[model samples]
Target: MKQDDTTEGAAESTDAFGGLTPAEGLELLRVGELTVQGRLAAASNATLYCTVSDGLRSAACVYKPVAGERPLWDFPDGTLAGREVGAYAVSEALGWGTVPPTVHRDGPFGEGMVQLWVHGDETVDLVALARETDNEALRRMAVFDAVVNNSDRKIGHLLPTASGHLYGCDHGVSFAEEYKLRTVLWQWQGMPLTDDALTRLAALRARLADSADPLRQELDRHLTGPEVFAVRSRVDLLLRHRVHPYPSPDWPAVPWPPV
Candidate 1:
């Protein structure tokens, strides 16, 4: 997907604080501008962290990047920052529930974005949370992930807020528009769609049909037209082919473990 779009120094960073841990990342901050902090959570190809700014006085920022992440394929640089920004922007534009404002930054660490921290009372476990899958809210959450082409959404990424609203994190690999719908939400398969759920999908369909106008401009450019149509097809398929068992728990993890 044109991962080669940016080269080193092409995208700038405000400041560089190298090799910081999640705890350490919270300590470093600057206000008004985005700052590159230390690595937070590391996956096969990316790290999660709090991009800090001292002036802001806010301690923690949460984001996932493929900074040290390796090439999943022959094309494009596998770095996380730029790709996440694209996917996040696209998802946001399509009017889905997604990460809050991500600050696109130019910095020494290369191009990347910062995500608003999701406050979860405890660590997330999909199977555990699956217990609550029947709840309309949770079901909607899974379905949203599916529709967004959110391939990296693991059970771990769904944070359970204190209020019980499940927040999704790490969406770098979303919006490919083909073979991109990945997640574990089949537990509610065949469950009748609430008016709200059906409405959300219907609304998304309305947006996609207007792809000439573009529901998400970023996706319009990044994903091919046919691919975007495929995405729409998958969404329709999910609603139609879906069985009562919910998503087949049999699907293996999205190949990229963490966004």
Candidate 2:
């Protein structure tokens, strides 16, 4: 992990995690002991801020216990934690670090989703960033949200790090069977897919087509059969259209409390 000079209102610097590699970070998160530090009172669910340690290594993380999830009418099949993990799987498979390193594990509360904490660059205006059309990372994230059918891509979920990397969180309501991509990132809507996006989607489509693909297997572990299938279907649709999806006329184009 690397540290940035600007850390005024940031949660914790990236270097606070002890310069762990992605594999090491994931391993620590998967096996380390969790100690609750405090609760994120702003979240709708029971989002706990904690430190995960395996004695030798440790990092700050957010823990969302399945037992603490608030039920939603639209997504009733699986636990929100599972959906969070599923969303991480999609992001990772695309080779996009849009979502932080997240895993499903047992914690003090119960089985839930645990993700590496990101300290966003507080200097960036999220509202302005969400509406930017020239950002490559944001464009990739928009495609990702479309694939996952993310229903809650609030401006607050955008985690623009001081290191210039962008990540998103609160994916508990994603992977719905219906087309419910309500996001503030519609800047690329109806535009031709970027060359990078086209290539990545093509690769993702092939991987999802294979049942033995690890990505598909991981998705199955969290999402239902239909939900997983819906993911593949969504990817196929994107590749077929070769363009950014338009906001659905039926569903609200953006989430409530956009920030």
Candidate 3:
């Protein structure tokens, strides 16, 4: 099997198959047959590159099986896949498009997180992009990482696509009840949130409060009660403070091998 496709790498080109809406993509990933094409060896987890097909439509995707997940002393065994899905849910709620269409479902390797593969723009300098203060996309992602309590947001996770969209992946270590945010995009630290961001956060906070909301239901399925509650708490804090958070002194300010 071919290898060497890191999340930072220009992935197997799939721009032609990128026409599907997020809803359509989610449906395909949910019920389609997944055939593993290769392994993304750079991933810490068992991340398999695959194609999902419902006969008429097919697209490249990344599948990280729960069985292949490495144990972290802090996270419960077999829960990483769910956290990945939970992150996708939050991204969708925020309407930020930071995460690709991802779903947790049964695959060749058993149940895991199946995410649409993103073909990153090879020309963008990710290091410089991460350090920029005025890049709206990266700033939005920083807020996202804060809300999810993402413990690992390396420079390599940034995906700047040719379609003028910025996305990020590798969120299997997110949504802890404690404040564990660590990231490379801290240029907006302590800055007041933009009006647009506050509007989105308010909508998300309202949706999260409604127990009957689909977002709440989906989050419940993937996250523990306290973890889900913690997401709400984070949003509340952001709205109350109305500013991007500072790095937590209790946790590492940045991930190792930041790139």
Candidate 4:
């Protein structure tokens, strides 16, 4: 699958797995201002860093194909372009400090996921960051992610900013109502959820119909109904039960390509 970059919105560029190029595939990135620095990692698929123009701003970007391009167990459609964008959308709203603002860019050259460039150090885990928080916001990030039905969040996806803040990446496989809660963030696997976190879960459930909802389109048909309910229940569970991180074994052990 190939990727494309379009300053125009991706309204016309929608497709199964966001419609990668038939031939050029990875090479279609020549039109962008950002140059391919290097291959970050190659597990689920591929990832690369490049320059991108979002709205009126320009910044470095991580580019990669939508889920349909790669074959991981989590994404049944093999593509969750809509869902990945949804996760980023919600993350940005709450100032989660985890997901950077993301957009779906496409054009004559390439098409796929394009997100704001996050310039910072990639260190620190949720547990280490959780220690410093009084409200336990660190632990809540995991619960919030799970409530959103994040399907893939290995250790490496969580990064530390130079300022000591924690950030999350690689949520393309999120928002499925089933057993998609898989991550290494559950150090205290059986911990209870805080009141504030519970509220956010309700907010997310209420916002499930958000016309701008990113996951609404990408969420699988098999999971469409339950997935929406899952979002509601996951929020309730985090609010009611002390849901800890479950074992993410069948989950892919490799890092998602950082494109």
Candidate 5:
């Protein structure tokens, strides 16, 4: 994977939110004209660089239309966009701002997922930072991945912003009912969860338990009932154990092209 450190063009990049908050970004994505800027060649599905504008405000974002999705034997077809939005909902519900603001809406290509693009700062070495097992943000990401059963949490997905915050993306393969938590961030394997982490997990468990939880309701739109149930189960299991999970011997612990 190529290392992206070019802050010089960030002013013109898609993530240039122009001081817009995440909530505002979501609204822009909903109402803005989604003009395709380019295609992201590395993704298996058709991922595009797009801009959304409402005549007054505009923002750069990534767009993944459901029609462009390739079939996966493991995951049901045409649901990748929903899973992406579901991941964002789960992230916000946990109060972990790990995912950039994302929404599922009608786009230039049809129904798809539009996300506020996150431009990572080239200054921070993400690989080096991942090795630091005690990094709070990474730790929370690990927990978030575990809850979502993220199957692709490669180093490239971990974006470090100029503000010193880390944001993760490419969650189309998450929320699997099966055990498929593949990621490169296993630095804290077997370590006990911090008090703060435990507190967050408890809070998340309670939220998921609510029958009318907005996040769960949103997730139901994209995920199968069993998949959503599995997410709650993972939270319960994590809260019960209170430790970082070890990799399974049956499956690959980390993604290929680790960076």
Candidate 6:
């Protein structure tokens, strides 16, 4: 990941809140001035710090261009941006709001995925939090990772804000047709899902059942037909089992540099 010099300019004068709500942020990303500030070093792929503004309001976001994506043996290149958007769509469809607002648009580096930059408490240790059984959000996220076939779920990817809301990011490798659910959240393994979790799973399964559903249509743009079918199959399997899945013995159970 290469860093670019910060673009010079002040935020537009519009909203009182220097930050934007998820809905507003999405619009801004669609038609706004995207200025690349720098590169995020923690990411393996090219992730840029960007500010999007429509001259009335401005929002801080991360931009990941498909052109800069590193080739992976299992996942196809140039699909990461679309996957990111698909993850956000799934999160919204479930009404979980676990993923920060994201959109696919043309950026400084061409078409890419732009997501609202979440400000979280760095003091919080996600690894330790993942171990605690009390965090229901983390548990839901784990289930979500399973449904999406997330290949990466590092501790650092879990962001907890001061308001106690948790958000997950870096979902470019998700929604694969294969069983690649590797993550640090295994504390709930073998445990039965809560009634609420089951309800949400049922809702997601129902939405995906309709070929013309908005969520399915949105995901169809990002994933292949078979890949989308796999997501529905995973949801069905989870509903049938109603228990947290155990790690697969054939593949590495957790991500590297878990934190």
Q: For all the candidates, what are their Cα RMSDs to the real structure?
A: 10.4, 4.4, 5.6, 10.4, 4.8, 7.3
Candidate achieving the largest lDDT:
3
- List model 4 lDDT by residue over 1-259, tens digit each: 1111221232122121123321122223333444455546653555666654333334455766553256656456644555656676566444443565555555323556655444445343444443343434456567657767675766556554443444567777787655656555556566666555566666766565564565444333224666667666665666566456565576543334311
The TM-scores, one per candidate, come to: 0.67, 0.92, 0.92, 0.65, 0.91, 0.91
Candidate 6 residue-wise lDDT, 209-228, digit = tens: 89899999999999999999
Q: Which ten residues in a row have the lowest lDDT in candidate 1?
A: 1-10
lDDT of 5 by residue, 1-259 (tens): 2222332232233432546767788788888889999999999899999988999988889999999999999999999999999999888877767788899998878999999877667777778877776567778889889999999999889887665566799999999988898999998888898787788788887877786988768988889989888998998888888898888887899998887
lDDT of each: 0.51, 0.84, 0.86, 0.52, 0.83, 0.82
Q: List the candidate numbers ranked by lDDT, top first.
A: 3, 2, 5, 6, 4, 1
Better of 1 and 2 by lDDT: 2
- Candidate 1: count of backbone clashes, pairs at least 3 residues apart or interchain: 22
- lDDT for 164 in candidate 3 is 54
Q: Compared to the true structure, candidate 5 yields what TM-score? A: 0.91
Error of 6 at 102 (Å): 0.6
lDDT by residue (tens digit), candidate 1, 63-114: 4443555665522465345546555544444344344345455444554556
List, in order, the clash count of every candidate structure. Answer: 22, 1, 0, 18, 0, 0
lDDT of 2 by residue, 1-259 (tens): 1222222322233442346655677889999999999999999899999999999888889999988988789887337898888888888778777788899999999899999887667888888888878777788889999999999999999988766667799999999999999999988888999887888888888888889999888888888899888988998899899999999999999999898
